[model samples]
Target chain A: MATIITKEQQEKEKMVTLVSSDSEKFVVEQKVAEKSHVIKMVMNCCGIESPIPVRRVKGDILKSILEYCEKHSKGEAQEVMEKWDKEYMDKAEKDLVFFHDLMLASHFLHIQELVDLIAVTFAGMLKMKSPEEIRQKFNINNDLTKEQEEHIMTTFGWAFQPI
Target chain B: MEVCGVPPEQDKTKGFSINDNADLLAEILSRLDGRSLGVAACVCRLWSGVCRRDTVWEALCTRHVSGGAATARAVVAALGGYRRLYRLCMGPVLERLPPARRDEAGHVSLSLSLSLSLFSIDCYERLGGRQRSSLLFLRNTVDVS
Candidate 1:
């Protein structure tokens, strides 16, 4: 006799439909989708039946986030996960534009772990770097007047001194 | 609140996304050591505002501050905030500093004391007419020191 799967079993294995801002649809496991607090809340409020829209995040960024969520939700070994996360971030950081988008998307989605990962990576880049080096890395323009910068440096000069 | 009272003296880059957002910027800046954070503050006016946040300095205080949390420190915190409090506390530990930094440590230590004296000056300001005298006294004292 053939085994008949119950409706409850099908519901138990239900996938969530995530629609990105650019109209890209991703059908992922509910566990993977719930990695984002915003998506989880939406699923709860709307009963997970309708396709949820992640409007602030574009397709490529949302896809990357979902990849991370899927990998993390798998309950892999710590070493494996750590290595994977490191490789993922290494790849992401190469393109500053992509990294910025990733950071914003994770932040908007309220994915604490992903945001922390991005923060740690950026902090690692900043560690022990001089002000000029930091400016070059981020391509930032100094907006302070020479006088203001000089004054603040003198006032808090000790902090800038190499340890 | 305004970050600085002055207009930009240079052509400002309208850096968007992570750079423009304080919460994201602080997430990265807060993890940095004092030297890196200080460097970041010098990066731009926006970074200075985030980098000087009391919460950022409070995290550093928890890490670097030894001994008990004193009530006296709270008084300094009330007036100048935790960054100032951390600066006052971190003035010592000559062993970790470079020779140039040792000189700066001494200079900052002196300034910290001068700022502390400003508290006494504040009390005198409350007592009336002596405000100008105290201000003059502080100016002269700072100049002399």
Candidate 2:
């Protein structure tokens, strides 16, 4: 299901079509679509006629992800992008489930940059927070017993040691 | 928010999906500070297990490197406890460490890169001293010099 797409196969003006899970099709410029690692492979293989079907991702998520690819394709200034990414992620994080789906979808698409960006963002949110606070953020639960829990705290005390 | 900050316990099975399972929970705890993660561990038995794992703690340590020694020490502690490190991938930055300090008293082994940076005895001792104090393990050691 996964194939490597080398750099040589990509051309600047090629055209491609992406079909969403719902059969909604989005015709994208090959230049913008190449940003997705998966599509790059398809182009590399010269496998035309197959409308790349992204079955797991919904239409809106696909749109946003493509918007990212399109904006990034312009070779925009890094400073401008850093500012945009910050704002982009800030708004994206608000819709937790949507953000999560986008992450999984990005993973499926094998968009390395997108995956790194989203993972780093999620990782950042988790930083310096308490386990409980983290659980609250993710709506997770504590399932271990008090004695079992204490054993861990005692055994791995070094992680808690002040530097 | 409750005093503990746990969402009001609606049901035991409420948020227990594979997506929010123990592994993910552990990942979340790893991002937190030690105190908060400690407090979270105390909230319940399951949380405690995930919080205490060296893998999780090691990740937290990795995240703290830029914060200062506290972060680096935390990572070292976590690494010390790990019987088998799941995955250790260091990028180019860690790749450029100078020669390891191996002195007469301590068999210190450093990459050639460190030899270039040794200006003072203090730096030399600190570089070599760590080897005398502990063993340094590198997956792939390159001679930079």
Candidate 3:
């Protein structure tokens, strides 16, 4: 049996425009842009004729996010995606500032998979790090008082030990 | 339901950190294991606060624990007291600790310091009908010793 491609189905492949915070314009397929829940919801309601402004995400972050969406939308094999995801995070992990901004953008756009990917990568980085190393890596202040720190050390001290 | 354009970007500094947002921080920390979570809590007040939220532990229980939601909630309620509960699923925290200080480990005595822990008994108490008899529970804490 021959399957028919309807006009409505053709609409799925239509292009959408996204404007980054700094006013850089991105032309993407509707399927690619729909990777963002926020964008998909808006396009569904208002139609995607006008370029949607992603007001918070900067151009660099939006570019990478779009790249991720475009890749994911291809319906590639699992190993390929996993490999792509690993390489994607490898680049993102080099700069904490950039990494954090990307996370913020992914969260804001409600892209659950990207958020999970970035988060899991972040967690993996900290998994082997000591408390002092984590503090140094993330530039966190030691806000715990002497007693509180002591208590944490006493209770979870085993976790700090070299396995 | 109609959102063609997102709100204008706010004037914020270039410096962006996940620590400033609890929700964001929780998302990252949620992907970590109980051991890393312990190390994470020791990082700062914000991480500590996020790590201790019942939701984080409940999520941990849900993933690493078995015997259904009630069991997960009970484990969260008991906090880290009932290490035995997750044994079937997560290999038990006890198995990870080097056995050199075997006797000194996991003793949740009815002491004040233990109460100060996020894994304190209040949650178990809050679980009410779960039979938290003080003697049995405390004695059980020493079973490994």
Off by over 4 Å in 2: A1-13, A156-163, B1-145
Model 1 C-alpha lDDT per residue in residues A66-149, reported as the tens digit of each score? 999999999999999999999999998976777888998999999999999998898888877777888877777778899979
lDDT of 2 by residue, A17-36 (tens): 88888788888888788888
The segments of candidate 3 whose C-alpha lies over 4 angstroms from its true place after superposition are A1-13, A161-163, B1-14, B65-145
Model 3: lDDT of residue B27 = 84
Candidate 2 chain A: 10-residue stretch with minimal lDDT: A1-10
lDDT of 1 by residue, B44-75 (tens): 88888888788776555444433343544676
TM-score of chain A of 1: 0.90
Model 3 share of native interface contacts: 0.67
How do the candidates rank by lDDT, highest first? 1, 3, 2
C-alpha TM-score for every candidate: 0.70, 0.57, 0.70
* Winning model by lDDT: 1
- Models sorted by DockQ, best on top: 3, 1, 2
lDDT for model 2 comes to: 0.58
Interface RMSD of each: 3.5, 5.7, 2.9
What local lDDT score does residue A1 receive in model 2, on the 0 to 100 scale? 17
Global local distance difference test of model 1: 0.73
